[model samples]
Target: MSAPLEFTLLHPANLTEAVKQMQAHPNARLLAGGTDLVPNLRRGIGAPDTVIALGGIDTLNSITETASHVEIGAGVTLAGLLASNLPTRFPALQAAAEIASPSIRQAATIGGNLCLDTRCRFYNQSQWWRKANQFCLKLDGDTCHVAPKGKRCHATFSGDLAPALLVLGAEIRVENAQGGRWQPLAQLYNEDGLDHLTLAKGDLLVAVRFPTSETRRSGYLKSRVRRAGDFPLAGVAVALTRTGDKITDLRVAATGTNSAPLLFDDFADVIGQPLSDAALTQINKRIGQAIKPMRTTNQPGLYRRQMVAALSKRLISTLYEQGAN
Candidate 1:
């Protein structure tokens, strides 16, 4: 295996110092858990001039649950999130958090998962392999091999947590050299795979916050080659509320099919009805059409879309039945 290109490493004692280090080196990458960055670096993905390690920042490493909401620090590992009371409260998130294997969960922070880099079968290869393919839009060459005629990169977002959080109405705290503020998590991404995150240079994702909410029932589902250790080819989250046996709210979100996770915005039509067969079919059709899966993984885009639709239907039905009980 080839070693990663040499890069400077900086360890900051606190958020202020971390922010300052990031500000001074805008091209630097942040190292929280190193689950994602380290492997990618070894694979010759990104060679940042410096890496600012934030693990020493105590303020970014706790989970706080107020009556208003549950705030999870960025440094909180996926295993930690699952072990907390939050999982029992938000089973959809728990279901999502339980994915990608136990060892990865132990070291993978929620923030890193949320900020997962877009992947493509072509781009995520060794330098020689990528060079042989002449590179793709995500990194070196101009043309997007997935959609050669298209101008945008079609790298897929394969993270699991964002979809669950989106369905639960989550927000995120972002800090930078200037200050910190909260924004809807949905606003954190854009469709451009090459530059998906909407976060400005030097902005740090500090924590993810979910609004005070209790649904009748919620659930998550994903499709992959193996039960664990593989990123989802397609993932879905469903959250709903029933009022006297009639649906009052339905939120569905999906990931792994597009450049960024998608929160389906027009499920309002299903609000007044139980999840009838027709409603489920409609939901499936909407999602199957909405996602723009590309040849970014071993599976074809068609298969991913079908799995996404199937998973969405199955999970929504399961959650509805659980709520009925």
Candidate 2:
């Protein structure tokens, strides 16, 4: 590997100061855990002139509960999620946080998880491997090796937190030098494989707020090449609120399906109906049919599609069981 480049580091003590610094150096990248950024920097995948490290800002590492909502800071590490009260209250979110290895978990932030780069087997390689194939769209070439004839890129959405947060109806707070605003967690992404984040340049993600909904229940399930530290090839997050045993509200999101999280809007037609084995089976089938995963580093495309049903069923079953108890 090439020797690390000389880059200036900025340590901001608070959110406002960080935003100002970010505004001044719009090209500077924000670093929370540095787990993902450092590696990318060394491999020439990242070339930021300055890094604004958030570790010095204590406010960004907090996890607090208000009268009804849960507010999690952007700099909170995955290790914090595994160690927090979130597991008892949000088991699916906790489960997803623990999927990475312990070392990586300790060093990767939730913000990094939300902004994790999309992955493709052909693109995630050293400089040498890419040259042999004449490069890909994600690298230096115009053609996508995965789908040379397709118009759009097919990189996989590899985030574990995004689907879970979307199912929970989370909202993210983004601040810039001028001001701050909130956007539905779902809106933070676009359908494109490249340039997934919808945030404007120089905006810093402040925190994520989980909205209050007494009737709602949420869970996540994932499939990977290995049960340990591998990224998900297929993952699902399901959230629903029921009146007694009849569904009242439902939100379902799937990751690793395409460039962004896949929403099965057709399933909304069945909401307010009583849950039955047949209904659940049909719901699973619909989601399974909706997702379109491509071959990637995690697993084969065909196998990932098959996992959608099994994982979706497992997530809903776990949530239902929790509600019953």
Give Cα-based local distance difference scores for all models.
0.86, 0.78
TM-score of each: 0.97, 0.91
Clash counts per candidate, in order, are: 0, 0
Model 1: lDDT to the true structure: 0.86
lDDT, candidate 2, 95-184, per-residue tens:
556467898988888888888778788867766677787877876788887778986778888888888888777889898877889888
lDDT of 2: 0.78
Flag regions of model 1 displaced more than 4 Å: none
Q: Candidate 1 versus the native: TM-score?
A: 0.97
Worst 10 residues of 2 by lDDT: 316-325
Residue 42's lDDT in candidate 2: 70
Residue 131 error for model 2, in Å?
2.2
